[model samples]
Target: MKKLFNNYINTFKGLSIEVWWLSLITFINRAGTMVIPFLTIYLNESLDFTFKEIGWIMPFWGLGSVVGTWLGGKLTDKIGYYKVMFTSLILTGVFFFLLQYVNTIIGFCTGIFLVMLVADTFRPAMFVALSAYSKPENKTRSVTLIRLAINLGFSAGPAIGGIIITSIGYFALFWIDGITCVLAAILLLQVLHPKKAKVLDTVKVENPVSVYKDKAFWVFFIAMFIFGFTFMQYFSTMPLYYKDARFLTEFEIGLLMGFNGFFIFLFEMPLTKWLENNVNSKIRLVTTGLFLIAISFIVLNFTNWIGILAIGILLMTIGEMIAFPFSNSFAIERGKKGNQGEYMAMYAISFSLANIFCHYFGMHMIDKYGFEFTWNAMTAFAFVGVFILLILLQILKREKAQQNL
Candidate 1:
């Protein structure tokens, strides 16, 4: 056991302070997001908001995230990664704590939006820092490891939030989340402090309108947007469905989200490590994942049994673990060294778009057609995403080959 432990320690010796620090950032931020798994519940039950109201407020959160993505990327490229990351971390913590005072719907929505915006801005800077710190040989593995830390944090946070919410109410969850983020930010300030890189090029950034001219980038973005649109509903609409159906309690919902984190912790490393070099691995894994997501949601409508819901949740978790990392790594691999921040910024936009559309459309669809129809429609959307992603992968492959020639 002593020899094995020594080997484990030695294995990580090749990793830099920057990579380790970024992992800490991811873990801390993910812990804060645990409160989000229950935010819809809190708003509905504690603050007396309707699903439609939540949906309307949802786009503001996405808009905040978009601001984060843009600012983090641009600032990381201009000033430095550590500066942007550290600032965002502190801001995120402050806003999360502010949620405690928000009683009205407008205040609540504004609080959530600001918190997400600040929290999300750290992401592009974090990813760019990780990529900058890693050797080319280990880039993909480094990305996977960071994601592993995030999932591990997610696993712990939801379970902890569940207990806190049950014992002390929703305010306690926000407080703990805020405190953890501050602690993590302090750690970031102390260790893995990244020096500013000398700018070697001044490539003009394409405006949003001009950016759409890149067919490949658009293809990737659209694919991710569709995937996110279907998957993000789990955080909002699906929880309400399960609650209304009496298939889960507040704690149970937290437990279900925790289960996703758990399996990712247990399984994702070996799975990604095995799939890393193989051609089309991203496409295959994500395809399977989308299939599982579609199937799980479809299956949920027929059963009110907690056991069946648990099984469906497990399936969703499996799909998530496969697709999330694969898509991220795929985007990184396709990007140039100097432009990684830009690529990640664009990638982040996909999820924001997903949240906006999923919440906006899913809420309306649920109101008109009910949970069964909404989920079924989302399943179809997931399949369409799968098809789009695969086609894009094929196109990317051909483009690469042509460039090689």
Candidate 2:
């Protein structure tokens, strides 16, 4: 047991202080992420929204995310990561406070859009900051550390959110979420103090348009898009499935969701480190992860038994542990020094696009067909992502060979 604990501790030893601070910031921010997880439920039960109406409204958040990521990437390169990160954090907190007052459908939809527009900017900037702060060799571990923080906080958020929703109301959830965002921003303000002009001058100025021209990146983008679309069902449709189809309570739903974070918190860091030491191929890791995710959904089709649900969630969490951090590392590796923000922004956009597609299509399927269909569709989508990734690996190899020649 002592040796086991030491091995886990050793995984975190050499990372920079900035990486630790960033992880702390992520923990703070994600701990208060109460709104989005429960947004569908809030709309359904509190506001009396139909599934169709909820579906239409949900995609607006994704649309805003799309805009936010694009603008954040540009601003990060121009203004420096510190400023972008600070501003995004503060503004997003303010927007979360504003979201509480939106009562009608249009008002709530617009509020969701605006809140996400500001909130989502933090993602790309965070990635850029992570890349800037860490050495090349520590990059994947750095990303994994941040993800570990996120999962730790995520484990708390939904459990607390379930309590707040049950005990106080939805309004309290907003207030708590907003306060935490502000607190996170304040912490960030204290930590990140880059010399703006010098930093900007030092950064390489890549043609932003060139990112779109890279065939390898485009292939990566497509794979990320599909992976994100399938994965996002956990946030978009799975909660509703638990409540509506399985007749679980909000607290029960929260527990189920929290299990994802709990499992990731326990295993992701160790798994990532082990993979780094043993697995030479990022493509293989990602392909295996995607298959695990597909199988997770397929597990759900077999049984709604609580034990089976836990197994499915565990599988998905393992998939996430293997896939996402490596994917971010792969993107960072693909880009030149100056283009990290641009590349990460594009990667972030894939998730934003997935949010739109997942909610729109996933919800529509649930409304028209059923949860079984939704899970099966997600399984098929992940398989497609795997196929694309395999092709992308080959293309990258060919490009590398040609460069050598």
Candidate 3:
């Protein structure tokens, strides 16, 4: 047992102090992420909107995420990640507070878009910062550490959001969300003592190839889009399924969602460390992850028992543990080969598009057909992602073989 503990501890040894600080900042920001997870529930219950209406409203966030990340990519290349991160942190916090006042369908459409626009700009810049702070050898583990922080915060946010909704009301969720975002920004500025020359890469890569010209990256974009489509149902429609099919309360749903984060926190880094040493093929790793997600969704279709929920979440969590860090590291490596900001922006945009498609499609399927049908549909989606990744693996191997000559 002591030897096992030391092995786990060794996974974290090489990361720099700045990487740790970046993880801390992400934790602070994400811990306050109370609004998005429960947005579907709030719209359905509080506003008395139909599932269709909730679906319509939710896609605006994806639209915003797309627009925000695109602009952030441009800004990061021009200004530096340090400034982009700081500005996004501050404005995103303010937008969360402002989003509370919106009530009508139009208001929500506009408000959610704006809030997500500011919020998601943090993603590519954050990725760039992760690469800048850590050594080349430690990049994947650094990504995992940051992800661990995100899941840790995710674990806390939903549980706390559920309690807030029950104890005070939904309105209070906006306040806490807004406060924490701003607090994260302040802490970022006041607490993190950054050396400007190291973290800020203001210099441009001259004659860089356009990301649109990269065939491998476009293939990756497709895989990530489908992955996002299949995986994100955990946030959008799955909660409604829990409420409708299993007769769970808001608190119960939150606990189940929190379980995803807690599970990832406990095991993702160690798993990544093991994989990096043992697995040479990242695309293969991603394909395996997608297969797990397909099973996760299909398992739900087979069993109506509540225990199936745990089983589904477990499978999905492991899939995510495998997929996300590797995908992130892939993007970082791909970007370094050409224009980092451009490649990373497209990476973020794939998920933005997925966010739009996933929520609307999941809600529509559930509303029109049933949970069982939606689960099967999500399973099919996951399998499609797996197919794409397999093709991607073949393309990467061919490209590597040509490069060797």
Per-candidate local distance difference test: 0.75, 0.84, 0.85
Please give the lDDT score at residue 303 for candidate 2. Answer: 69
User: TM-scores for all candidates?
Assistant: 0.80, 0.88, 0.89
Tens-digit per-residue lDDT, 54-135, candidate 1:
7666677778888878777778767767788888888877887888888887887788778877888788877777766777
What total of clashing residue pairs does each candidate reach? 0, 0, 0
Per-residue lDDT over 152-259 for candidate 3, one digit per residue giving the tens place of the 0 to 100 score: 888778779989999999999998898888887877776553653345323346788789899989999999999988888888788888899999998898789878
Total clashes, candidate 2? 0
- Which candidate do you rate higher for lDDT, 1 or 3? 3
* Candidate 2 clashes between residue pairs 3 or more apart in a chain or in different chains: none
**Could you say which candidate leads in lDDT?**
3
Better of 1 and 2 by lDDT: 2
Better of 1 and 3 by TM-score: 3
Clashing pairs in 3: none
**For candidate 1, what is the lDDT?**
0.75
Question: Residue 118's C-alpha lDDT in candidate 3?
Answer: 83
